[model samples]
Target: APRCSRDEAEISPFCSLPEHQAPRCSRDEAEISPFCSLPEHQAPSCPVCCGPIRGLATRLPSCQRSRSAVTCRLSGTLLDEDNPPLVLPSGHVYAEAAVLRLEAAHGGGAFRDPRTDDVVTMGSLRRAYFL
Candidate 1:
């Protein structure tokens, strides 16, 4: 039987048992083993495991679907140079007049983005310039 290392013995109580008495710690068994309770054996956080700011980089682009084809979510009409699209803070694109009308309907107060539920104001809307 293979001997447990000093560090492994200290972390795993089963390591102290005799070879014949001890149950094998296979990779799958280790997941549910009592040793997993140790802080050092815990899973790493997103930042630690993936590197700082990697989460943001790995995230899918919010406007990926809209970039390929432009359409107003509010008016359900194809967007063109004549009726340009404006991008909301939540990344949804809508017709400029449609957004203005929506804002007006809410008494010019902050409105909730339908896609992500993010609060947005007319001042924060920007033109979508895909290149």
Candidate 2:
């Protein structure tokens, strides 16, 4: 007896019998099956074939480590997306307004980077380009 595709087996009354198991269909048979002739019978719900599924999972974009580091220490708030960030010489970045407030509170003297013990000044601050 000739084999039928899973799609054809699902719809054909001869192949649906519990006593008569249908054989797997070849690529050529799959293309010419009676079930493949119609568009509505092509869905996965029709029947699951005994073969590996193609492109089962989709790929996603990689995560950005820098974006997760855009939190301010002084204000405890996230950096503004529109504003450029202030990068300290000690390699720490913070919101511009927060750094300015800290400098003002300390009377324009050297302030410590919370992440590191290194002393930094307003002159040591520069604009950072974070993507």
Candidate 3:
């Protein structure tokens, strides 16, 4: 069966049993969407890319890693969609190829989300934001 929309799921929590057990909410007996259950402090998380969660994890995967920081590339258009076109801290203009190269250069690591200060890939971006 097709899953309902997020708003509908919010309104009609009892209507379906998630394939995974229903997530307990910290607020409102009126069940919260599993997707929205993460504590507010742990934001900018990309669940799709980051995969299964454990407990109230409050930091991004990037924050947990102890590696030298990688450069993130962005175009004016992508930046416009996500944020204002302020000059990059790195002062670089990233075309699509540059993004591709970034992925390659990072040894196929995920893209770091500038907005959220998290790491996410293109596939994860589509799932978490678009869907």
Candidate 4:
């Protein structure tokens, strides 16, 4: 098991070993911690914590999905340059023409989110682009 000073353990519990294996010492004793062999909790074992971080980074990745994976909620199709994509404040995506028609159907006042019914406006719609 990697070692960590008590202070390091306190600051980042993930840096320390299991509870049963943790060496206990009186706060006044100033004894060496079995985990880190340090007089006081100061140093941290980077290996232990780095492993978890790297593991999570591998298990869950980012920016791996392509733009074609994004589908418009209104049209139920992949967003394209011809139709373009618009995003509401509520994070709902729709084709530009579809948003215009929906807003016109609502008489051009504050529009409501189809899913949550939160009021938004056509002007509040923002264009979405992916690279």
Candidate 5:
């Protein structure tokens, strides 16, 4: 069966799924799609890329690890579209929310670096962009 796009330029294991089972979201649809965050409409997350999910197992094949998965150093969770990995000036990486929470716990604008015991301010944080 023809499971992938007719364009023939891109190939992925996702091509094997039925039309209805294909991903509901596309990279360009973020600004226009309304169902991106709806659980029933979201595609199943890859197990290896997403780490351990609670309550229910992931639908992504556990046997094959995604080559692009990058995990957050503090939480060990995948740095995916939902949870971005932010970087501190001291050369440390952490989840976006994790850094924010740590700063808030200390005093709101400054947080102690988990690695070097140095104080890092929110102004020194940088966004880590991934492909």
Candidate 6:
């Protein structure tokens, strides 16, 4: 039978061997961690968070579908080339200076009218922008 006891081996693996094992200290003790330690956590933010932002927020000369994959109007001319109207996909229409934010179902993005500076429904401005 081996002379070394389990308790002694548990305390020190090197006890049976000629070389001494590294020390094991409590949290209070300052000791270097293992060479290959796992990280605590990863970055929570994802690139897809702004997926809708890039799709709808950008200034599109014509109408296009948003990241949510919804066809909507981004901008349009209200009174011919001289005046323009801004509309969003939500169905709300504004003349000037109105702000509209797309919901999660829509695209989870924000749209502001350059002409009226307002938020308008996406459907309303499609023809003017696309055509």
Model 5: how large is the Cα RMSD against the reference? 12.8
* Candidate 3 per-residue C-alpha lDDT over 2-69 given as tens digits, one digit per residue, 9 for 90 to 100: 45444435444533777465443323333334654455423233342233543222221112223322
**RMSD values, in order shown:** 17.4, 20.3, 16.0, 17.7, 12.8, 23.0
Which candidate, 4 or 5, would have the higher TM-score against the true structure? 5
- Expressed as tens digits, the lDDT of each residue in 1-131 for candidate 1 is 54665545544567678888875544432223354345443334322123454443223121112234556756766677877899887677888777777777777866767657677887898898756
TM-score of 5: 0.48
Give me the runs in candidate 2 sitting further than 4 Å from their true place. Answer: 1-69, 81-83
lDDT, residue 125, candidate 5: 87
What is the alpha-carbon lDDT for the whole of candidate 6? 0.35
- Of candidate 3, the 10-residue stretch with the lowest lDDT total is 55-64
Candidate models: Cα lDDT each:
0.60, 0.55, 0.39, 0.58, 0.62, 0.35
- Weakest 10 consecutive residues of candidate 2 by summed lDDT: 54-63
C-alpha TM-scores of all predictions: 0.42, 0.40, 0.22, 0.43, 0.48, 0.16
When sorted by TM-score, best at the front, the candidate numbers are 5, 4, 1, 2, 3, 6
Least accurate 10 contiguous residues by lDDT in model 6: 40-49
- Pitting candidate 1 against candidate 6, the one with the higher TM-score is 1
Give candidate 1 misplaced runs (Cα > 4 Å): 1-69
**True-vs-predicted CA distance for residue 60, candidate 1, Å:** 28
Cα shift from native, residue 10, model 1 (Å): 72
**How should the candidates be ordered by lDDT, best one leading?**
5, 1, 4, 2, 3, 6
TM-score winner between candidates 3 and 4: 4
Q: Taking the tens digit of each residue's C-alpha lDDT, what string does model 2 give over 24-124?
A: 43344322346533543333422232123212111111123332445564565667665458999977777887877777767776676766767788887
Model number with the top lDDT: 5
Clashes of 5: 0
List candidate 5 stretches off by more than 4 Å: 1-66
